[model samples]
Target: MKKEKVVLAYSGGLDTSVILTWLKETYGYDVIAVCVNVGQEDDFEEVKKKALATGAVDAYAVDVVEEFITEYIYPTLKAGAVYEDDYLLGTSFARPLIAKKLVEIAEKEGAVAIAHGATGKGNDQVRFEATIKALNPRLKIIAPWRIWSLKSREDCIDYAQKHNIPITVTKNKIYSRDQNIWHISHEGGNLENPWNEHDESIYMMSVAPQDAPDEPTYIEIEFEKGIPVKINGEKYDPVTMLTILNKIAGENGVGTIDIIENRLVGMKSRGIYETPGGTVLFKAHKALEKLTLDRDTLSFKKIVAEKYAQLVYDGLWYTPLREALSKFVDHTQECVTGKVKMKLYKGNCVAVASVSPYSLYNEEFVTFGEDDVYNQKDAEGFINLFALPLTIRAIMNEKKIKEEKEVI
Candidate 1:
């Protein structure tokens, strides 16, 4: 009889490497490793070889970086959804795509089960499982971290040594890392302490601010419907454009944020993230939105953005409401096409200039001198009507005060 096959979301890292071996030894099942490349710069060939050498019956490396940026990154940025007003949602955004790919492969390969390395306590396990269920619920999920006795990184390392699997992992550098096209996040290690300061060693994607150039670097980013289309007037593919921007932004020490964020699994985790290109794109998109969107739409969109952040962070990307919210966000992006020039210096990405073709800015109406576009006297009736409710409330309050004083 043929053995039941399982599709594992593998990264060629220590955790997934050990899981690949463990699944074979414990379950006596066929473990097929699938590694999705979302532009983390890892050598997929080497990863595939390592997976095959360890225990995987078959290994596949799927390139999904362009799809990831276009489908996942762009929509979130267009909506201006930043988790907790600080997190760029780099890791969060990648989870759905990775999970979706894992499921797609699982179906193609006719696998009975899908497994992952995400721990029970982390947000990613929720994200991976939620996406898989949403996409294809019939497939069984085997989360080893939740059930296995290998409770800590140390145990995993010891298991690797015993299994004679050649790998590179140390106990001292225990900060869990997740890297992709949008950003790289560092957690665990000393970051578990809320009061601890994030050292420069934690940053893997960007240089330290102190090591950045003394002079500021200026760059221009062009957008079409809130999606960044060009850099310095040169158009490129979604992946290449972001790579160029990441290099430029990182050299100037652009994106580095440290925060203690609430995980989806009912725990607060501290992390340091490096999001060079994403920072530039998000800020520029928001600045363009300000100049283009009307007051009401923009204000209401701010409220929507807050909720949108929660939804995405909680692994609800495949839900109906997320699609509904995207429709609304699409309308807001109609006029959010433009170019923004920014100055990057020492971990700061400051917008210096921004303009959109559909911008509501009017020189004549805003002019200090006399202009035909406006009649100064028109403000009198407008103010009176606008203030009517306030005026009535104040009069009623005065009357009530007088009655109280008389009674006293």
Candidate 2:
């Protein structure tokens, strides 16, 4: 009898590689490994080879970098959704896209189940399972960490050795990492201990702030309706633009954040994120919005931004709420076209100048000197009317005080 097919979200890493073999050996299933590449630094051919060697009947490597940026990253960027005001939601957003690919491949391959290597303790487990269930509810989801006896990374290492699985991770260097075009995240190992300061060596995409060059790097970014279009006057496609900016900003140590974030699993997990290009894009986009958006719209959108970040972080990317939020965010981006000049120095990405065609700032109205656009005498009446309620309250209080003295 043929075994039921399971499409495993394979990364050729320690956990997934071990899962590839363990799933087949334990469940007696024909494993089809699928690896979705979202601009991570990995050799896909090697990954496929490892999957096949680890007892997977077939393996696939899908490149979704362009789709990831244009579809997922751009919307979140437009919303300015930063998780807890620090995390850029890099790993959070990538999981949905990867899970989406898993569903597609599972359907195409006629697989009955989808498997993921995400541990039960982390947010990725929720992210993957939630996206999978949202997209294809019928498919049976198998999460190895939640079930299997392998409880720790050390156990995974022992299993890999016993199964002859090739893995790069060792006990000495055991920081669990996830990487993509937007950013790279480091967790596990010393990060689990909040008292342990992250070693500079763990940073992959960016230099340490202290190690950055003395001279600052200035760059001009141009956006078209909140989507980044050009860098320093040269237009680039999404992939190329991000790649260029990541290198430049990483060199300047532009984005490295260490935070203890609340996980969707109701636990506090500490992680270090490196988001060089994303940092630059977000700062530049915010600067453009400041110049173009009115005070009320900008203020209200901040509330929307917090909710949007929460949705993305919780892996509700496929829900109607996220779609609705995206529509709202897109509507707000109509005038978010402009050029922003940013200064990058030692992990700081500051927008120094911004200009937009729809800029609401008026030099004549805001100038301290005399201007024809406004009359100084008009302020007296405006202030009087604005302060009328306060003045009335004070007069009433005085009358009450005088009446109380007479009564006494």
lDDT of 1 by residue, 38-122 (tens): 9897999999999999989999999999999999999999989999989999999899999999999999999999999999999
lDDT of 2 by residue, 141-164 (tens): 999899999999999999999978
lDDT of each: 0.92, 0.95
Least accurate 10 contiguous residues by lDDT in model 1: 196-205
Worst 10 residues of 2 by lDDT: 118-127
Against the hidden true structure, what lDDT does model 2 obtain?
0.95
Roughly what TM-score does model 1 have, to 2 decimal places?
Answer: 0.98
| Winning model by TM-score | 2
Clashing pairs in 1: none
Candidate 1, position 166, lDDT: 74
RMSD of 2: 1.0
